[model samples]
Target: MRAIVLGGSFAGLLAARVLHDFADEVTILEPDNEQEHRTRSGAPHRDQLHALLAMGHDQLERFLPGLTEELVDAGAHLGHGEQVQFYIDGKRRPTVPGIRMIGASRALIEAHVRRRVLALPRVQVLPHRATGVRTHAGRVYAITSVTPGGDCHELPADFAVDAMGRSSRLGRWLEAAGWPAPRIERLRIELGYATARFHRGHELPDTVVAHSTPGPASNYLPSVCEPGALTAVEGARWDVVLAGYTGYRPTSDPAAFVNRMRRCVAPIQQVADLCAMEAEPTTFHVRDSRRRHFRELPRLPGGLAVLGDALASVNPVYGQGLTLATLQASALHRHLRCGASPHLPATGYFRRAGAVVDAAWQLSTTADLAQPHVTGPYPFGYPLVRWAADRVTQASILDAEINAAFSDVLHMRQHPRVLTRPRVLLRTARTLATHKITRPT
Candidate 1:
């Protein structure tokens, strides 16, 4: 069997890797030439903050052994997820001691994985853009793509997967082919944020630190600090991001960026004041979290599967995109590994991928909707879920077990249901009463 994967990104690369176990030929369609340990021009978020959640690291390790050590050796930082100060509404949470995670730029992670996937004998990359899909008898048979010159070529396929991120063309292709397009779910969040880079030239006091302020003031003041990987490959530089909700936002001026940091996290302000600026602040457009429910549709295509951002995109703030994509890849692997059929079923694969998206979507939307600035209708179980989440955040600050549970869920290592257990609820209630919870000031 042969498979066509669109987009040679983290998700696309992983999909290619997974398909190698089942297909005799796999081609990854990507526009940019793969580069090692460098930033990706296609994904501007590479300039922003991207942390490899504990679960994502674990999966990457499973698929590519010693991958974490390779990244570390290449100047990435590896440490506990709970190794730093976590603040909410300007107050610090009693730090939880031991949840593991790795810190590196998106390019670093993807480069290493790209090298590994391309090393596979069955996988190959085609530096071209897939323009359209040619289907027959309710199944995709070929894809049309444009190469370097003004020329078009059709490549036949047994299976095709979409990992094209936000600019996915599958929906358009599906509509043109007279097939039912996946139902899209959207949560509108008009977010404005600014990011700037600075170099310390020495070890940072902490690996990662975040501070968020409760609104009802001027704007949502949420801040995050992530130092570059600890190795000497990249200097002691840190990525600082500040988000302003509603109409307020940060400035591109280096001086103003530091001033914004002074108002949020403590060490961040010092890092800003002392370090050298790498570049001017880059503004970010926080759009809606969109999910194309392919599983909901009674589809016509038999060999089509959507993965990664092409399938669903949650709020980037949660840091679950990479993890969710790989989970979907793993699901694809499981489906292909099914021995009963020589061909993979589209509906079954979509449903499995949808389950992974559902988890991240639930967690992201629930939290985003709770914010006053985001305009969205109440999801299935709103007020109760919100109330419980609030209590858990507060309770986690004081209770070690609660904190551990919360971290586990946040990292996608456990289900959100873990927070609703009888013991957890009781402890949250107890902590809420006895602990002098400071109202969001």
Candidate 2:
């Protein structure tokens, strides 16, 4: 069997790696030649800080043994959960001591994973842009591509997988081919972000500090890394995103950037003061979250599947994309091992993948909606739930158990069900009561 995967990204590569077990030939078609190194124009935030959740680490280790070591060898930082401090709503929860995570640039992670995938004898990566897909006799027949020399070619395959990022054209192609369009749900979030790197030895006190605005205030989330490097990401709602949103943008004027940091909460200001700007500030647009309900489509072409951002993309702020992609790949592997029907594999994979997306989506959307500037259809009972969540945040400050529970969900180790456990609710109530009693009248 032969398999062709579109988009040579984290998801595409992982899918190809798994397909190697079942397919005689597996080819990855990437549109960009520049991906040979630790830089990708396709992923604008490639240089930004990315932390692999514990669950992601587990999946990588399972799929590719020594993968974590490979990343560490490539200058990635390994830290205990407590090493990274998170301050929410002006309260710093007592850190959970032993959880471990890998922190590195998105490029570094991609580069290392690509190297591993390419080393497999059955896998080949062809640098070319995928223009469209063609099906014949109830099977995906070819992936259309344009070569660098301005020529067109068709690469035939027994199976085709789309792992292209957010701007995938597969949906339109499917429609043009007379297939029903995939169901899509989009959330409009007016989000803007600017990022810059700085020398790491600066006088920063914490490894990570996330300052969140409970209402309309702009917020900053900065990360400290190895090699004497640090990255600061400042964000705001779409309407006020320019100058008024975060009160600052990534500017060549270092003094101005630092001055804006002063407006953030305390620790962020302290970290901002210690470093010299090392890179140019780049700005990008962040719309809302989007998901293509491929599984819901009544008829999908046999031997065709979509994975990664092409299938669904969540808000990047949650740092869940890579982790979820890894989980999806693992799910694909499991589905193949079961010897399910060809059409059933694609449908079953999407059904299972939705559960993973739902966990991350709820966490990210609810948080985004908390911003006063963000507007959307609030589901019935959302306001009451939001109020309860705010109380949980308040309680997390004093209750170590509550903090741990929240962290587990944030890290993707536990499902959202953990949040609704009766013990958590009881503890949250007691903590809130204690906090109120301690306040001076």
Candidate 3:
């Protein structure tokens, strides 16, 4: 069997890795040169700080064994337990057992993953732009591609994947080929963030990761502390990022960026005061969170599947993109391993991947709705849900057990519904009540 994967970034690389197990030859279509570990021009946010949550870390290890040790040996930090800090409203949440985060830049992570994937003998990369999919009788049989000089060509495949990312042309390609495109749902966020790297050495010795965001005490505004995060990434460098919505969006000014960090959580502030800026701030803006509901389509071309940002692109602040892609790749692997035919539509894969997308969407979009400027196609009963969710967030800061439950959902290891469990809800209510009764006021 032959499989073709479009867009060879994180998601495309993972998809190719999975396809190698079932397909005799798997070709990755990516325009960017992968000869070095530097960020690609196509991915402007590659230099930005990125998170590999506990589940993403586990899946990555599962896909590329010994990668963790490799990363650690190469200087990437693995923050476990207390070293991985999360703060709400300027106060750190209670440390929870089993929590973990990998401190690495997106470039380093993608570079390593790409290297591992390309090392597979069955996989090869084609440096060309994928123009469209060619289908016959409701099944994709070939991919139309073009060269930099405008030469067009076709590659036959038994299976194909669209990992083209947020601005994927797959929907348009499918529509042009007379197929129904997945309906899209979007929530405009107008979020902007900037990341700057600084030389790191012996600073925050016990801390590898720190993230701070507005919460209940500040009414989800940056009144108490500006929302920011930082990690001890490779090359003995600290990668710090500050985020804001609409008018409060971070800027590229190096001094202002550090000043913003000074107002964030202590770890970020410490970095701002202690470390020398390695370079100017790199910025990226997010217009909205988008998801393509493939499962909602009545029919799709066989021998085809979509993954990664091509499926869902949520708020990056939540750090769910990479994990969501890994999970979707796992879903694709399960679908093929179960004897599901590549000659037919990947209904089962879409269904499984949809569940993952839904979970991430619920977690991110719900939080995004908290922003005052973000008008919502609000979820049913959002007011009540928001109240309950805020209480859970507050309680998570106070109770370790509740934090663990909340962390699981935040890290995408478990569904958000886990927070609604009777035990969790009861604990949250009791914790809030106790804290209320013991207030200094």
TM-score of each: 0.91, 0.87, 0.98
User: In terms of TM-score, which candidate is stronger, 1 or 2?
Assistant: 1
Q: For residues 285-354, what per-residue lDDT tens digits would candidate 1 score against the true structure?
A: 7677898978777765877788888888887767799999888988888877874232334776777888
TM-score of candidate 1 against the unseen true structure:
0.91
User: Which residue runs does candidate 1 get wrong by more than 4 Å?
Assistant: 34-41, 206-233, 340-344
- lDDT of prediction 2: 0.68
Off by over 4 Å in 3: 34-37, 437-441
lDDT of 3 by residue, 171-192 (tens): 8999999999989999999999
Model 2 ranges off by over 4 Å: 36-39, 202-253, 265-267, 343-345, 437-441
Angstrom error of the Cα, residue 407, model 2: value is 0.9
Scored by CA lDDT, what does every candidate get?
0.74, 0.68, 0.90
**lDDT tens digits, residues 69-145, model 2?**
87777666665655555655344568877566665666767877888899999999888888988876655788899
Candidate 1 overall lDDT versus native? 0.74
